[model samples]
Target: MKPKELTRAIVQAFIIIVLLIGLYQVVLSIQSVLSYILIAAVVSLVGRPIAQLLKRIKFGNTLSSVTTIAILMTTFFGIVSLLLPVIFEQAKNLSLLNVNAFEATATKLMNELSIYLLDYGVDLQSWVDRSLAEVDYSFLPDTINTVLNGLSGFTIGVFSVIFISFFFLRDSGLLERMVMVFVADKNIKRVEKSIFSIKNLLSRYFIGLLVQITVLFIVYTLVLLIFGIPNAVTIALVCALLNIIPFLGPIIGTVLIVFLTMTSNLDASFASVTLPKTIYVLIGFTIGQLIDNFLTQPYVFSTSVKSHPLEIFIIILVGGLLFGPLGMIIAVPLYTALKVIFKEFYAHNKIVKALTKNI
Candidate 1:
């Protein structure tokens, strides 16, 4: 290469490296604020359609933004209000169990399993018992207090999210203008198109999230009711909400439902049964999960993110491997955003072309 060309190449490389380093430092410094910002952005995305509807009706942008936020807050607090009673009742019932039926069920199951496993030379029951014996069971109070203390911070973050999102929604052109300031004039239109695509996709994704949760909650509740579980509504609501977290969340929620079912009798109004209704609970969960896996997930993924189910599966698996549960939860929306951007800016790149062809 000519000396002049080599010097220019080196300068460009140095500039790119420095920019990357500065970006990393800024991200690190604003990590806490970044979360709130992301939350606000999502809020803005979800509220966009409503804001647009109001705008079409001749409502001012600021008024529509506040109204949308008000609706969102009301729905959030309404659900929280409903959950608190169920939680309090669960705690009360647990405290009242002097000789818990759940413990009896566990001991009985273990004894039977121990006898069955003895033939295989694998003592699963004893191992479980030993593990349980080692658990502390004492820090629970301190943990509760710590969570209570953190409520203030959580409240602050909530307010921050609402505050930022209001501005985001009120000024629909604000984000576009802000992004354009950093874009070259030649690429500004492309960036604007990409931003529009992202907003539309994310809006559908989050709105579909609410629809998914509601459908699952109702289905789960009805299934549990058929099995004679007294706290069907509570369990179903929690499990449905947890489905928002993706794969791990559903599994954890199902396990929790099973445990709760194992503690209580199937007959809420009749004579108390000695044994836990494990079999019925298992059946209900199996059917409920099948409905979730086969029905709800396909519709939501296909319609919301506009991606194939298999593609979403691969992305989520990669996310889980790279960053665990949190990564898996965010995998779809994050991938969709990146794909949009890449389609706009790197359309010539073969891999980007392949990945974004469907989008």
Candidate 2:
């Protein structure tokens, strides 16, 4: 390569590396506040419709925004109030567990597994011994402490979300108008239409999520109860809510429910219960998943956002690759907004035409 060309390439590479490092540091600095900001954004989007309705009815913007915040807070705490007692009771159950018996049972199971694997020429016992020898039991206590501390830290973030959401909801209309000023005078109406469409679409998307969660909770609770799973309420609540995360969520939820079913409340009723409780648990979850996949998701993605299922799936995968789980969670809404903006500004570009064709 020529000297000048090499030097220019080197400078560009150096700039890119510095920019990436700076971005990483910025992310680390804002990690705590990012959660609050995301909460505010979601609340503002969901409350936008109700605030508009209030405006139509002649409610003052400040009063309507405050009322919307109150509604969101009350709904959040109402769910928390129901869930907290269940969590506390389960913690009490954990504290009362017989540790020695638990250890003995685990050891016995490991031995039996070792014996079974002997027929296949695998020495599971040796592997278990090696793994146990290297295991750090102290990590368990440290992990528990970290989780408790993290939970306590969120108290401040919760209040921050509410306070931030109020300003966002109150001035949301003004902000929308302000944004339109950046567009050419002739194209301002196009930007306004795009913004209005985004708000309406996102509102439906969020309302659809609440409906999905409620439906899943009811279905999961009923299924677990029929199988006599202990802590069905808490498990159902957790499993249902986990569906909020994209792609990987339902798998995590199902695995957790299966583990709880296998470990809790063993007896003749469990053993002679027609089918193994584990199998029953799987069956129940499979049915619930079918409902979610066939009914809930289609309504949320297709009807609410007007995106094809395959399109939504690909967007989620790309988002997960780029930005991790949070990226996947927000992928639909972000993609929708981008599509609208592109259609508004780049209507003549071929790629833009293809991407925003639906919108």
Whole-model lDDT, candidate 2?
Answer: 0.81
Q: Count the backbone clashes (under 3 Å) in each candidate.
A: 0, 0
Q: What is the lDDT of every predicted structure here?
A: 0.80, 0.81
Tens digits of per-residue lDDT, candidate 2, 1-359, equal: 99999999999999999999999789767856875776688888888788888888999999999888888788878867766765675566567767777667667777877899999999998987899899989899889999999788877888888888888899986556657668788987888889888888888888888899999999999988988777788789888989989868899998888666655543223334523778878888889889989889988887778788888899999878866887788788888888888888899999998777766
The alpha-carbon lDDT assigned to residue 271 of candidate 1 equals 22
Candidate with maximal TM-score: 1
Runs in model 1 deviating more than 4 A are: 1-25, 53-59, 100-109, 132-153, 263-276, 317-326
What pairs collide in candidate 1?
Answer: none
**Using Cα atoms with residue i matched to residue i, what is each candidate's TM-score against the true structure?**
0.81, 0.79
What does candidate 1's lDDT look like per residue over 137-213, in tens digits?
99999999999878987899999999989999998777678779999989888888999899888878887788888
lDDT of 1 at 197: 93
